[model samples]
Target: MHTDLWNYALALYARPGVEAACLQLQEDGADVCLLLCASWLQARRARVSDERVCALLALAEPWRIEVVQPLRTLRQQWRMAAQGDAALALLREQLKGLELQAERTLLERLQACSQQWPAGSDETADDWLVRLAPDLCRDHGALDQLRAAASALQDAEDGD
Candidate 1:
């Protein structure tokens, strides 16, 4: 049985350094959701292409900018005030949850977009990440950490 993208993301994110790596990537203007999808695609050995990447971006960019980014911005904006105010902290937590949910929904949409693409690719093993990751993140050690974690996650699952 194949693992769905959400679960795969959760498991991968739970891995050591992955969360930090993702955050670092996000800081560098990379989309964590896109990176996760890239890792998942590589793990599944799915084919990678310009059209497929474009399709994923086309489906995800608006949702990220309009939905995820706003919630995340609000949460970040409240970080300091929320630190001192209990009620504000609660609201910020709620906002954080909403942001998470928005990202999850984006992941689900991405999965749906690529679900029909068959596993097994003519592309190189790293092609998915290489293509999907932001150029700014291309040489970051955080990116390497994510790549390592994804590989370890794939090995652990295959061992199951």
Candidate 2:
């Protein structure tokens, strides 16, 4: 497993079903960056607590709202326009890269904030997922899928 949060995120996001699952969670008001951070923490075997989860969200929420989402919205909005206009397609691609960088930055900051946290925990990956997105649990199917994906990521990391 990659120790750097950005690399870890890229690898995890590429896994089958993860991108779609993350988008579903995001549409349900979950912060995908924080979720990725939670996954990273789980991969590292970090102790998770409500307080720690709250603190990480506090650090990530504003930037995600102000910087990342706007870029994402604009990039998505341009999808139709970009399909026909070559120049527009080029510019949209650039915005997509910027949006990705913004997310990468958020992940880096999350990693920095949690660097001092101690590892060694018996908590399952679902424990962190539940703590991070409690509301999602209301949808059992979605929550179960997310938990499975997260657990798979942790299992893969453990094997590395």
Candidate 3:
């Protein structure tokens, strides 16, 4: 299990089905960075309170909206345009890297904000997931899949 948030995120994200699960969660308005942070916290057995969850979201929302999403939108918008022009494809790839870096920055910020919280005995990954995305009822299936994937990864790491 990696102690650093960024490494933990990369390893967890590389798990089977996790990428698609994360994309599905993102489509439902969940912040993937926050979700990854929550997974990290859960793996560490950290305390997950409503207040802390809210605080993490508050810290991450602005960055996600202003930086990550715009780059993502541009990359998506350029998908077709990049198909014909080699230069456009190169530029879109660059934007994609920027978007990834922005997401990494968000994860770092989130980890820094919550690093002081003590581990709790009562909360599960599902608890963090629900608090992190309260409106996830719109797609219960996707939410459940994410919860399962995160929990599985955390459990795997903890068992190591």
Indicate the TM-score of model 3. Answer: 0.89
Stretches of model 3 off by over 4 angstroms after superposition? 120-126, 137-139
Top TM-score hit: 1
- Report the error of model 2 at residue 155, Å: 2.8
Which candidate do you rate higher for TM-score, 1 or 3? Answer: 1
Least well predicted 10-residue stretch by lDDT in candidate 1: 120-129
TM-scores for all candidates? 0.95, 0.87, 0.89
Candidate 1 lDDT by residue in tens digits, 11-104: 9999999999899899998999999998889888888888999999898889999999999999999999998999999999899999999999
What digit string (tens of lDDT, one per residue) describes model 2 on residues 1-160?
6778788888878878888888888888888888778777877778887789888989998998899999999999999999999999999999999998998889889999998888767765446666777485446465567567767877887784
Better of 2 and 3 by TM-score: 3
Best by lDDT: 1
- Model 2: how far residue 13 lies from native, Å: 1.3
Ranking of all predicted structures according to lDDT, beginning with the best and ending with the worst: 1, 3, 2
Better of 2 and 3 by lDDT: 3
Alpha-carbon local distance difference test for all models: 0.88, 0.81, 0.82
Return the clash pairs for model 3, or none: none
